[model samples]
Target: MNRSAAPLVRELQPGEIGPAAAGLVLDALAARRDPVIGVATGSSPSPLYAALSASGADFSRAAWFALDEYVGLPAGHPQSYAEVLRREIIEPLGLDPQAVHLPDPHREDLQKACDEYERSIAAAGGIDLQILGIGRNGHLAFNEPGGALDSRTRVEILTEDTRRANQRFFDSLDSVPTRCLTQGLGTILDAGQLLLIARGQDKAEALRAALRGPVSPECPASVLQLHGRLTVLADPAAASLL
Candidate 1:
């Protein structure tokens, strides 16, 4: 695939990010008869979700797909990506639970579960737009550093840095799952459009690398530049390095 020179990067105020992102979603909804949205869970996307919730938009026809989920968590675990999406996206937007899809992390046959997730996405006609949040270490979804660029939906081992960053969502650091099922770089890039959001100074370096550095697995998000249609939204602090 021919890589774009760079993604369209826009640095805006913290408050401005939400409405700006909402505009994009609203435009997409107006254009597509059936919209498939790829959802990301993290602080960076919280504002966008809030904006959508308040926009009085009708999302009944949309289908939501989570980007990743923690492995070995009991069903309905509060911190699971399923619950997070429920609390953040589904309930607030009044979306049907049946319209939202998440990978089954509790399955005994995880590889089959992953394959099924991929097939489900394909059956839905692939994602129209994918919302993304960058890890401090530049990981996309759970496709951590050192993962293959052409990877698909599968299991991935969490890096210590990633685990540490996510420990706040769990009772303790040890409670954070070491493994996750995630849509890999190849899977995410399949979307018709990609929208990445980042915030805070902690993300400055990662955002810089993803936007300006070489497309290397060491900074998984750098793969975004290889995408034909990608837009990055970041707060001034997060975009400082760029």
Candidate 2:
């Protein structure tokens, strides 16, 4: 264990997600002239992204990276993580799409691409801030529980729970991707700071486990207890159990 304390849980009032997130972004930008940020997919971080997008934040010099991407989806697919990010965050912020890094699992040379992406992140001076969301099964990004906590960016078969939760992205539940490419625990730890965001009642148990449970792969987000600077942000529903 890294000897760091558990994440500081706080209850967010209605509509406070935006200001809270904007404050974090402002803090990051002020701390680093060109911050390297890691972004996650799904509905949890949407409010935060929206707030940052409208903050008039100048990201021209900043570099952005995603936590994961579906393996079989085309880059242009509406459900693709890349597309979701572009539609919700990158485009709205007027960021150079070229500067935004997304894992291209569609490539046959996925291993090579993963290595290259890691190299690019390292070369850009590692991440100053990494935003995150917890899955129903306590997964972070696509680093699902039962998998090795020390793992790195690579392909993974999505768990059934994950698929069910994300089924809306597809025409039918069957259309949801079975696999993904996600940054490893090592990659997430390389960041100087990390922010894990959550909301809703569905996240309560997972949030409680992450806060009170042991550091085990059974609850992957528990790994944050080892990081030096990790901030867990959650709304009242998500904070209920905590």
Candidate 3:
């Protein structure tokens, strides 16, 4: 593990990922009141969601926000971040959906909506823990590498690698929108703590570079290495080079 250059690089044994994330959540809850947390979408967090569901913790006081959303996808879409979260965490936990907020996918005034989203986040108090899933291209959230780190909540053109990775979620690549709205690195970093979760060989190289490589927009997650409390959790294959 490249401990010297990155945050803590934790190689967790199989079947341990969910508990780890839940533990982190509990830790955060113990650390502060009504903690603000950032969530990520997709399969990587399924275990985390399950673990959380089993925790029996009271989160009525917690505030939730997510990392990104696909532009043009209806909020009602099964694949939409909002619905995915509602299925995985909200309804099951009986969380107050009104307290949980995510970027709206169907907004006609996208940038303004993002601006308001950012404002709401800031007003609710900055995020306490921001969970993330990296892109095959080293992008964090949807802030594709090579994009400005100082960016805020805004629209982004989905990169080819990102589109390919998400193709399975859609009927076909042609159906995927070319644009998305994601919380930028700067916006994400505002969170007091961050957790980047990676698993499987598909993310091995990207994981290695994020921990050992240079800090650059060329590898957006690399910037997390600069944060005081960023944590990278992965299985052995994802931790191949450290």
Could you say which candidate leads in lDDT?
1
The count of backbone overlaps in candidate 1 is 0
**For residues 184-214, could you state the per-residue lDDT of candidate 1 as single tens digits?**
8999999999999999999999999998888
lDDT of 2 by residue, 95-189 (tens): 89988898778788888878887888889899899998999889988988888888888887889999999997789988999988899887887
TM-score of each: 0.98, 0.96, 0.95
Models sorted by lDDT, best on top: 1, 2, 3
Model 1 accuracy (lDDT, Cα): 0.93
The alpha-carbon deviation from the true structure for residue 195 of candidate 3, after best TM-score superposition, in angstroms, is: 1.0
> Which of 1 and 2 is ahead in lDDT?
1
| CA displacement after TM-score superposition, residue 215 of candidate 3 (Å) | 0.9
Q: What is the C-alpha RMSD of each candidate to the true structure, in Å?
A: 0.8, 1.2, 2.4
Task: Name the runs in model 1 displaced over 4 angstroms.
Answer: none
TM-score of 3: 0.95
